[model samples]
Target: MNDVTQPVSRTVGILAGMGPAAGVDFVRLFVAACESWLREHGHPVLDQSYPEHWMAQLPVPDRTLALSDASAEQPLDAMARGLRQLASLGATAIAIPCNTAHAWHAALQERVPEVELLHIASETATDVERRGLARVALLATEGTYGAGLYGHAFDALGIQCLLPDQAARKRLMQGIYDGVKAGDLALAQQCFTEVGEQLRAQHGDIALVMACTEIPLALPQAPAARGWTLIDPTAILANALARRAYARA
Candidate 1:
């Protein structure tokens, strides 16, 4: 008689709703990443082969608003609650899709020490480094810029990050809040395109890192955006989470 072994199982958690749409988009990316993993590992694409996962689309406070205004209700508590909820539900590893929300990543990780909380900026920086890119432009919310989330990560990898000017940054924020968040793709496309063009003109044709999850929704559609190399941090983080879920024990 041959000995049989049980397949290892893991649960992936997504703490989202920073913006409802971005959260939904991350789910699609995760599924795609899982499919890629299946092909790479030579595993059959059976329903049972996928890892169990749960997403909590909690109505958390606005991360960008919280970060910019001290008086605004901080997202730490709400995010922590969400994290705890997922951990309690048997989530072995977790990923938060919002870039601005990652500002509270350390605190959230501390609250749920048992679960593996993937860092979006760290994973993105690793991907950028692996691509041998020396410089990149960042298009993100003012909160992410002020927090220096991607700045610190890229700096650690010795990758220079080109930032938009004050006006350009404001435009990018409007693109996120007024455009994508408001369900106006036309406005979002214009704002993202203007910023992308400005950054490209100022620094060369380097890769533009869509550090904000919302940016990817419209940036790809910009006409001028076609000439630039776009890096999707959300996708990078999703792939990282996928690898974690499928890692051999």
Candidate 2:
């Protein structure tokens, strides 16, 4: 069924507005996942189902924001407010798509303790350990860098998380918010390939967690890797979400 035509159940709360593109990615994943779930279980796919809710009708594809070191809390507040909004609308749980904003998950949880948050970082860490990857490299923003969000989560689960070196980090920061987040696909691919190659040189033979959901828009899963496996948090989270949605269905 097309996204527009799907039957939406209770509203799914999404605390978005971190980097607009990441939020867009999560919604698309949610709808597409629902349909994929439907087909996998032999549920009938509708040719068209008018969305009877707000999130189902958010009319835009690319809502990307340029991120910086300054004012991270604004996005977090946006997330919390959105969660409260969805909860008021009877949403069962809330999911935030941006990895960096996950730094505020604890606070958000405190604000809306009744709403369940699909912890992408926590889930990704578990998956990293489950895959037997002891040491993995991460390519995310400075916020995610300073927060040590993934490292703490992964360490708790017996996995080691590595950050890019200073020089690589500088390039990565420029590459993401400037290049990829700006809708420059060509530039984005350039940035991803550049960062990927740099990471290979600096630290070889490790899984590179595309911690930033926006990173995958640049690095699609087509060309096979020689020494690195791209760990996509979006796909990982999607699988986890699908499992949850199905188990409870």
Candidate 3:
């Protein structure tokens, strides 16, 4: 077992670039969280306030295509290589921002057992439990939904995971792929807010799980507008990483 009590001055690995934008957003959140953690604990902001992070922005094959098509190149090898690269750089822990990529998490862990890989969905589910939330809505790619990655994790924690309807799911996908991935923030915001409204109306006070990392980036307004909370897995994962990196100090 790793002694987390030791100083975590070592590098943290970010297994990212599944879609590129989401990966960048995740790292930005991590940086912000580190700054916030230091300030909240009465530590003045300094140049070395944050841990060194190695970003392995793998040009891995498309996760959805790889999952749906039998002949498509599997992303397993590329993802494994990224994890191994991080371990080679002596990363104490790793964070994969993409939810769809998490489908290969177990195999990736097997390839790099020395470091810890943070599970975004599991961390989000844990947050839901801590907040005493019974049910939450999922807004993610079709690949993530089909894999039941978030659903299974939330279920194990006695939380009900609500999914968008077919039409709503399609809208969410448009926001992720055509909007955010394509670098059209305006369109992404439009699609995200519209779909969020639909989900909020249908579910009636249910919190939303931004299972797709890009969703949070594209959100137009916080759920406070609807008197509900939108759970951001990326933010949760980043904050968790910050805490783990500084816990011993």
- The TM-score values for the models, in the order shown, are 0.96, 0.80, 0.91
Residues 1-249, candidate 3, lDDT per residue (tens digit)?
433432345578899997788888888999899888877877667765678788878798988777778699899999998888888987878999898988888888888889988898889999999999998888889889988899899999999888888988888888888888898878788888887788878878778888888888868353433555778899999998877677653
> Which window of 10 residues has the lowest lDDT sum in candidate 1?
1-10
lDDT of 2 at 126: 84
Candidate 1 pairs with clashing backbones? none
Q: Please list the residue runs of candidate 1 whose C-alpha ends up more than 4 Å from where it truly belongs after superposition.
A: 1-7
Please tell me which model should have the higher lDDT, number 1 or number 2: 1
Model 3 scores a TM of: 0.91
Count backbone clashes in candidate 3. Answer: 0
lDDT (C-alpha) at residue 21 in model 2: 73
Checking candidate 3 for backbone clashes, the offending pairs are none
Error of 1 at 116 (Å): 1.1
Question: Tens-digit lDDT track for model 1 on 81-200?
Answer: 989999999888999999999898898999999999999999999999999999999999999999999999999999999888999999999999999999999999999999888888
lDDT of 1: 0.90
Top candidate on TM-score is 1
The digit string of per-residue lDDT tens for model 2 on 6-89 reads 444544556655456766777777667767877766567764421222342222222222134353324555566677777888
